[model samples]
Target: MITLIAGGTGSVKIARGLSKTVDDLIVIPNIADNIWLHGLYICPDIDTITYGLAGVLDKGRGWGVKDDTFVFMEQMKKLGQDHWFTIGDKDLALHLVRTNFLNEGKSLSWVTEWIRKKLSVSTTIMPASDDHIETRVETQSGDMHIQEYWVKNGAELDISNIMYKGIESAKVNAKAVEFIKNSELIIIAPGNPISSIGPIISLPAIRKELESKKDNVVAISPLIGNKAVSGPASKYMQIMGIESSPFGIASYYRDIASNLVISEFDNEYENRIRMLGIHIYKTNIVMEQSQDEIILSNYILNIVNKA
Candidate 1:
């Protein structure tokens, strides 16, 4: 079985692409971006993967259900709610059910599995942890949740500190660890390394697991030519004093990954990444369309097949 660690839009793209050609795949998504707003628990990463695998993702918006209406959010704004975090009508239904289940004392992993089954998604999807592990970005204004920084502020603020709140006390899900331990191959999807994959690896147990199986791990760099294909990953990397390029990504994952897949545009840095003892897999990492995703997915699988 193949296990993937991913978060948000980019991860979901790879998940959807891999789902078309691969079975027995499990995705462990970052939950640090989750937030509680307007009395609902909004898990952006989980919803992204769920919607993507279910073939109901809003491709144009990159998140939320396709053709979803924001009437609920509009009504909330009229009723004097913040509504800064937009929640569409159809999208709210999933949150409503998930919130209800949580209120009834259901584990997040259980609720996630239930949602996956409901959506008829064959690819298994698991949240990194059932506990709260919010990603907080300390900016010039103040420390705020990841959504506040990414959406409300347009990620324009210079981050002074990027922290994973509640991670020290957070417990890694056993099922997620089990899948990782038994996987034939592990791939860290192209997403924000800090905000997306950071929370999961921050946990001692999960980090240890990855370190033990580092030889079989491969990571797809979110950066190409010192720029991100989407989102503010490049900005965060810069704030952390890490170079905003494929070489920076290699340094970040060097301890946990043996191979790093980079875009052909960043071919110049392949030898530089190899200097860090990481094998390089060069390809067109940008997923502008479904075809691109399929090609990349097949490329990664072929590499695994050879192993």
Candidate 2:
């Protein structure tokens, strides 16, 4: 089985492509971006991967169901509610269902599986943990949930720290850990290393498992040159005193990954990353269209197959 550690739009795009090529693909998505809003539980990364794999994602917006209406958001706005985090009518239905299930004392893994089967998704998508670990951003303004920092404030503030609340005491999902242990290859998908993939790997058990299987782990850099493909990954990296380049990405995953996949645009960092003892694979990593996603996925698969 191929296990992909996923979060954010970039990772979801990768998941979409891999789902087509591999039947035993398992996606372990980060739940740090989850939050409670409008009295409903929202899992951004999980839902994005689900919608994407189910072939109902809004490609243009990169999240939520395709052609979803915003009537619920509009109604919230009319009621003087803070609707900065845009939740469409269709998207709200998911949050409502998740919230109800959680309130009924169902484990997050169970709820997620139900949702996946309900959508007729064949690929396995699991949360990194069933625990309530939240990504909290510490900025000059004050601490706020990652959703507020990224969505409400547009991630404009310089962050001082990122805290994964509840991670210390949280248990890694046993099934996810089992998959990581038994998988033929483990891939760290291109996403925000700090907030997206960070929380999952921060767990002691999860990190230990990856460290044990370090040689089989491959990381796809979320960066092209010094800029991120999307989101505030570059900003977060810089704020945390790490260079926002392919070299920096190599350094960040040096201890956990044996190979690093970088964009051809970042060939200048090849020697620097190699100096850190990582095998580098240079290719056109940008997935601007569906064809690009497939090409990148096939490229990675070819590398693994040859190994």
Candidate 3:
């Protein structure tokens, strides 16, 4: 069994690929991105992970369905609707079901587990907390949901602060903490440094649990060539007065993660990261177009086992 901390497309790809190589796959998805829009409870990160693992993801955009029809959206547009987020018909069904369950007071963990199993997803996925922990970006312009800043505006504004709104009240699941403590290895996948992965680790128990098992924790860098391959990691790091380089990433994981892994192209920074007292591994880190995610996952598995 392998426990993965994940959010959005990139970590979803890692989780999907790793499932093929590991039995008892346990995914700790970011719960900070959940939103209630248009009377539907939408979980963008959860759906992305579930769809990607199911092999029905729209590869091009990394979200929504493959070649999914927007007829429903077109109809709404024709009716003068001004929806900010794009939700496909099939995708809306998922949100609707989720909303109904939540309205009935079911926990997010229960609903997500139920849906994943209904879709025949063999791997087990869970949220970091059933308690709400909304990620808010305090920008110079104003406050925005993490997704609105990262997706809607393309991270154009200057960010002043970033935080998980309700994380103080969130509790790390006992099972997740147990997995973290007793697992042979724990991997922090290359997701957004702030909005995605940060929120999951902010829970007091989770952070303390990760600290307790620092020896076996390994982090994969989301940045390559000093820029994030996807999302607003670079922007957030800069806002936090931190550099967005390989060494910068290693510094962030200093005490929490004992090992920091980089890509083959970033081999030059191997020694720089090592100076931070972090064990570094140089391998191909990008799951770019035409690259095999499974093969990449296998390489990562070997690294973790060796750690």
Candidate 4:
């Protein structure tokens, strides 16, 4: 099985494309984006991956259910609710079920797998941890949850610190550890390195386990031509005083990831990136179209298979 550590829509796009070409795919989703909003447990990354792999993702937005309506969010606003993070009616269904299950003492991992099966997704999707590990961003204004910084404030805050609240106590999901230990290859899908993927690796045991198999890990850079395709990754990187380029991405993953995949358009930086002692693969990393995603997925699989 090919185990993928993924978060955000970019990674979901990769999962969607890879599913068409590979079998026995297992996804470890980031739960830092999850929040308790409107008395519902909202898991953005997990839902994105599950919906994308299930062929029900909103292609235009790269997240949420296809053609989902936001009548529920509108109604919540009429009731004077803070509905800054819009959750569509259909999308809220999953949250309702998840909240109910959690209230009933079901684990996040169990709820996630239940949702995946309900979505009819073939891929085995798992959460990074079952604990309440929230990603808190300390901005110039003050500290706030990741969603508040990312969605409500439009990610315009000057980040002073990024911390995973409760991560120190969060244990790696048992199934996730098992999958990583047994998978033939491990892939870090393109997404925000700090906010999206950082929380997953922050779990000490998970990081240690992954570090033990660094030789089998390959990371795909989220940036293309020195800019992120979507989201506030570029801005976030800049705020952290890190270069928002392919080189910066390679540097961040230098220790855990043995190889990096960058866009063919970024081939000029291969030499500089390789100086970090990480192997580089330059190809079409942008997923603007399904065919593009498929080609890139197949290429990565071929590289791992040949190894």
Q: Total clashes, candidate 3?
A: 1
lDDT on C-alpha atoms for all candidate structures: 0.90, 0.90, 0.82, 0.87
Superposed model 2: Cα runs more than 4 Å off:
none
Q: Which ten residues in a row have the lowest lDDT in candidate 1?
A: 14-23
Cα deviation at 298, candidate 2, in Å, is 1.1
Minimum summed lDDT over a 10-residue window in model 2 is located at 231-240
RMSD of each: 1.0, 0.9, 1.7, 1.2
- Residue-level lDDT of model 2, residues 107-213, one tens digit each, is 99999999999999999988878989999988899999999998999878878887889998898899999999999889999999988988888888888999999
TM-score of each: 0.98, 0.98, 0.94, 0.97
Model 4 clashing-pair count: 0
Ranking 2 against 3 by TM-score, winner: 2
lDDT of 3 by residue, 1-307 (tens): 6788888786877887788888877888888998877788889888998888777889889998777877777887788875668889989888899889999999888999998988789887888788778899898879989878776787788788988888887866776677677667778889987878888888878888888888788888999978997877888888777789888888887778888778779877887788888888777778764345687778878886665
Candidate 3 residues lying further than 4 Å off, grouped into runs, are 289-291
Alpha-carbon shift of residue 276 in model 4 (angstroms):
1.8
Q: How does model 2 fare in lDDT? A: 0.90
